[model samples]
Target: MTAYEAPALVISECQQGLLDPPPGAFSGLAAQAAGRGLIERTAELARAFRSRSLPVVHCTIVHRADQKGMLPNSYLGKMAIEERMMVEGTRDVQIPAELGPEPTDLVSSRATGLTAFYGTDLDAMLRLQRVRTLVVAGISTNVALPGLALEAVNRGYDVVLAEDCTAGTTAEDHRYMVDNLLAMLTRITPAADVIGRLPG
Candidate 1:
């Protein structure tokens, strides 16, 4: 089999609230994403994957209006609840306009948790598509992307992280996580490299 056999693009937390947060709400993360051109790179990757008919899974985090089933166990969680971010029907939970889900793409949304797989059918959706390798991208390499890489691996999927298509709270934080944590869990590659390797 080829290196990227049955590969799928799994974009995590590319939502407006997370990647393009309002003023005073994760502004640092928004700045980092903009500085690195994270959305544009991920959009390029998404286009390439779509061209190959590969599954493009958007793993989003959203909570209900009442915040039921959502736990404030961590600082981010508590902040999300307190800030009223990522509520289901809000624009904050929606993916940015740059990257389209298109007609064929899959969106797997979860009400709680950091990783996409914890309370969602992301794995099942991928499995249904016969996906073997996961090309991951999106926000905050410090948390979501790394968590996604680990969860994808534990669930028996090979992971390839598009380094340029993701960011963190800060440039230094992003670099450190990619070098120390994510590097240990996934094959860290640039978006162009991933696109070039896509099977026609």
Candidate 2:
């Protein structure tokens, strides 16, 4: 068997929102990350992680054919009717090229709207490769990253979110969520520190 790899990243759809405006689809803080180089930076980080021969996993949200409303447990379930729910195998659910994912990297979940790990067999993949710690990056730091961190920690994995690699709908929203929500669950370390801790 292969050795355990370093922590991996998971990104949410900043280009395609759960719901989007007609002009750009996703126009919130996640959209802002694109304008300010979030995608590029994420890809750059992916490359660095890859160079070390560490495992790099990608996560995206998609829905089943039923395409129904939330199941009452999801944080997203309480949202309004205009929100865009994941419909499996749609264009909005595709992984961005910057954080390229092959057929194996995509994980699916009918219950959890947060990650590709839960409901999917990603935990098995991580365990098989012996990965016990995670370095997470993505859009909507408030929602996606923190939610994912909760899931990972619950499953006995050490998680550190790359603070600079994530963004929210607003600068303050991002800051507040990280300070209040994520801080409660995990450490909010900078991307540079994450790299420093990795193999050189």
Candidate 3:
């Protein structure tokens, strides 16, 4: 895919809680991310964006300590509240050190909802920066990244999914979403190609 002007790289839900979960907590996803080298690839993309003076936004999922405003309507939502997963200020919610905000990058954290744009200032930040395209990479291709892509599209931003830099609960699940679902919403791309196409 050709590089689009004013593109921002949005890395969603790449927090420790999701990608490097505790024992017995989302082990499948953790394994998948590690096996696919998701962190390394995402880091590469982040660096590429930074080098080009492009925006790098980290979309993190986090909840308050009291769980206020965090709905328990869905199973995952309920689990997050009950298990205290992704609590703000906790290590679980922090992005991995391998990939960072780096003092220059922006971070948009959401207390509720699945997609980044829903409850955060992500769109406003993008608009302020005049970002026209969004390059997404991160965990759970089964859910969050796909949701982010759809939302970005609806918001009139072009989207490109860095397939190699994302991971789902399993390889099969990841492939299915990328092939059947995500492909319909955005251009599916590899990290290397995206990096190469970026302005130096």
Worst 10 residues of 3 by lDDT: 1-10
lDDT of 2 by residue, 40-157 (tens): 7777777777777667776655555564644656546543123554556655565665567643353434334555555677788778767777877777775777777888889998
- lDDT of candidate 3 over 16-69, digit per residue (tens): 888878888899999999999999989989998998899999999889898888
Q: Identify the runs in model 3 with alpha carbons over 4 angstroms from their true place.
A: none
TM-scores of all models? 0.97, 0.78, 0.97
lDDT ranking from best to worst?
3, 1, 2
lDDT of 2 at 90: 57
lDDT of 3 at 140: 80
User: Cα lDDT for residue 128, model 1?
Assistant: 94
Q: Which ten residues in a row have the lowest lDDT in candidate 1?
A: 1-10
Which ten-residue region of model 2 has the weakest summed lDDT? 13-22
- Error of model 2, residue 159, in angstroms: 1.0
Residue 129's lDDT within candidate 3 is 94
- Listed per model in order, the count of residue pairs whose N, CA or C atoms clash below 3 Å is 0, 5, 0
